[model samples]
Target: MDAESQRVLEYLTEVEEGAEDVLATKQQIVDLDTKRNQNREALNALKTEMSDSGHPELRGYNLSPLSTEEIKAMNSILKR
Candidate 1:
């Protein structure tokens, strides 16, 4: 191939690689968005459950402090 043709091919190759990178990044963004939505739904469900259960420690605006057992339970859940 001629010099100009070879240069063009190299430029095209670079463009293709850049496009692939962009696609991979887009996929990652989509996956993260899906995960974020699922986490939000789970959090909302937990909140609803807490409210419905009417546990004194988790009730109204004037909330009391958590007990030692509650703290341990929360810690265990967070570690997971």
Candidate 2:
């Protein structure tokens, strides 16, 4: 092939690879966002259940009706 044709082919190849990378990155971001939302819902449900049940631990700690941020912080701390 001519030099110009070869260069064009190479550029097109690079563009295709970059597009694939962007698509994969976007998919990862979407998946993480979905997971985060699910986790938040689960946390909220658990908090409601805990408060409704009047769990002894929460009563002892005076942590009834936990706020989302407080639960998130506690979850992070417990994970560590």
- TM-score for each candidate, following the candidate numbering: 0.68, 0.67
Kindly give the stretch of ten consecutive residues in candidate 2 with the minimal lDDT sum.
55-64
Give the Cα-based TM-score of candidate 2 against the true structure: 0.67
- Candidate whose TM-score is highest: 1
Full-model lDDT for every candidate: 0.95, 0.94
Q: State the lDDT of candidate 1 residue by residue for 17-68, as single tens digits.
A: 9999999999999999999999999999999997788877655688679999
Clashing pairs in 1: none
Task: Evaluate model 2: give its lDDT.
Answer: 0.94
Misplaced by over 4 Å in model 1 are: 56-80
